[model samples]
Target: MNRMQLAALATVATLFTACGSSSDTGPQPVAIDFKALVGTQTFSCADTAGYAIGTGTLPWIPKDFRFYVSNVRLVDAAGVEAPVTLDASVWQGYGVALLDFENGTGNCTGGTVETNKSIQGTVAPGSYVGLKFDVGVPTASNHLNVQAANPPLANSAMYWSWTTGYKFMKIDGLINRATPFTFNFHLGSTGCTLATPGDFTTASCTTLNVPSASFAAFNPTTQAVALDLALLFAATNFDTADGGGAPGCMSGATDPECAPIFPKLGLPFGTTPAGSQASFRLVTK
Candidate 1:
């Protein structure tokens, strides 16, 4: 080839390199989506028709839905896990992001109006086919310091107290009754011991209660994480509060209500062995 023609080809290559035709520019941005559902119905504060729940199939009004997800990792085609470099926001930071499904409208009146249905971040350019994540906030910022933590961590509605720590996940609904009481599922790290009972925060919790999930064929671009409330309440009796501290499961070790609830999360509680997690499933959008 002529020298002039070779020089022209080299210039074209440089332009392509500058435009980042491949992964040389850096990682790509990814937004893993999530949604709340009771069976096939997409859950929302605007739903006036309550969903049939529990064994009786009583209509249960969606009240509140929110949870913290941590240690998010994207899985490659070869089954290798890569940690997500999360984007910082009011709902995301510090290797954790709070997924809020409620908008404080209709029956979901107690929480904030803002909703975060996706985990925004960056991932290496590759053929990622799966996802892995934990169901709670990480230990470093999860131990009773909402006052000092970052945005999503600083959200007070999620935190309970200095002794108990943050309520890792909360999914509540108004159930059938003479009064139509609310059934609250406040799952968090229990069996805690404080360093100083009166002053210091919790030193450690015997039951971390951080259940995790991994889906082998998930696609962040075309699929979303669906948290199903119907299957979660399959064994729970909304009409009766049995062997429990509250009207619903409160993550207490002795609470029989929690025993049934934990297995739905693919976790073992008391005599109830771990079952496949029924609540979280990846669905095609």
Candidate 2:
């Protein structure tokens, strides 16, 4: 071959190699924003006289209450549930770190408390089908020693020394007209027979199965998950007249209210209502 032809061939080869490298780089990763909408609703007694004591705030009923939710999940269109694990170190950047009573920790008061916090992360571009996660801490991680917790997980007030575990969910406030009218909806593993003096052990305790659920098929790229706080109280039976606070009131013994509340909170074990299911909507922007 002629010298001129050989030189041209080398140049062509170099150009093709550069083009291949550019194609291999691919597109940038897509960012996904996760949000949780939380709130409460007022319910009247069975007689319909006035709103539930704990549900309302007045001179007599000073402790008008609210429930805390954390540890949200994001599901893709393929039905794969991705648990949005919050960084236990930094509570301010994401939102307030509320105590998860389901684990047995009482109400988390310290460290910028966030009711309905929203967070964002990067995920490969794809269609997400739905999202699901626990409204309370799962049985496994709930048994941690609160006294030893640090940073985001360190809150002395929420620790329940008597129970030996954290409160999974605390729906306490006021329930009756009595002074300090209160109905401590402290829900956790009832038959907690597990006992370990040191090193914390769950070898003997019965694991309480908290309920959770998901919503209808929704596209995440264009919609955002909106957790409705109001529906959480309305749909469930909040009738304080009956055993509303009974069976489970501070008992930690697997009460009726415990069963219903978890699922409504978009938990894995609770019932998912049609309207309540819309608690979370997906959006692209």
Candidate 3:
């Protein structure tokens, strides 16, 4: 009961130590594939229709589509949160990325030759259950001068100015049967304060307007994140403008035009939405 028992116990202890070290060591890096889609269809610069979104039945031909997302996170199967490491590039900087599907073609006159359809990043390998991200730029970076800001932030089309900051999201299209013939949806932080025209040390916006999106069972590798424009406008009449006379929602709290669209953007009539209520849907391709 002495030497044999000691040797057996020693072997078991060594085995347990090895297993524990394996579990605690660094896991392999996971490649997260981010894709943007419109319903089941692939969203691109080309013309497509049959978008039966809102009660109104006007066919939509997309001319431009772009949006910003930051603080991207993934919840592993173990319920551990892991932030994504964005690939360094013009379209991505400071943990933010701009998803641009338009390539300055057709009616996309305000765009450029380059377009970013998706963004890829790395995370610690694990079985992820959900994904979370913010729709707009954080307060610290929102008020910076566009010319001096990072790549995507420096892009003029995305910036309203140093005072107003950037456009969180922009989706524009032509409504086939609408009277106005256009549907433009732009979202950004409002109610911002600046000491001067473009002051860097401006006060935080009353309406931060950064709606957070969370997805359950979102696979970072096999599945793609989708934003269905049809659902976004399912209740909107693109042909008509609100009392404020905007063709579509433009992040204005009082704009009646935004009444139907704001909820979809995770923003209510006059307040930011709860973190869990995002308008974006996940699509697998």
Estimate the lDDT of model 2: 0.40
TM-score (all chains, Cα) for each model: 0.87, 0.54, 0.80
State how far residue 92 of model 3 sits from its true place (Å): 1.0
**lDDT, each prediction:** 0.77, 0.40, 0.67
TM-score ranking, high to low: 1, 3, 2
In the range 1-285, model 2's lDDT, one tens digit per residue, is 677765554443232221212111222122223442233322211112323322434311112122233445556646675554453334311222343212222322231223323333322222344555444445555556665655343444444456565554444433344433444555455556555555554623464534344654544344544433344443444334345446324533345554545444444332433223323344333
Best-fitting candidate, measured by lDDT?
A: 1
- Clash count in backbone of candidate 3: 3
Cα RMSD for candidates in order = 5.9, 11.6, 7.3
Q: TM-score winner between 1 and 3, please give it.
A: 1
Displacement of residue 70 (Cα, Å) in model 3 is: 0.3
Task: Write one digit per residue (lDDT tens) for candidate 1, span 1-285.
Answer: 677765654443332221323333366566788988888989987885678777766677878899999988888778998888888999988678999999998888788889999888776655466788989977666774567877888877888674447888988888767777788898888777776776445457888888888888776656889988887777777767455576777787887778767998988899777766878998876
Candidate 3 stretches greater than 4 Å from native: 1-31, 48-52, 124-127, 176-181, 195-198, 271-278
Candidate 2 vs candidate 3, lDDT winner: 3
- Residue 101 displacement (Å), model 2: 14
Worst 10 residues of 1 by lDDT: 13-22
Give the candidate order by descending lDDT.
Answer: 1, 3, 2
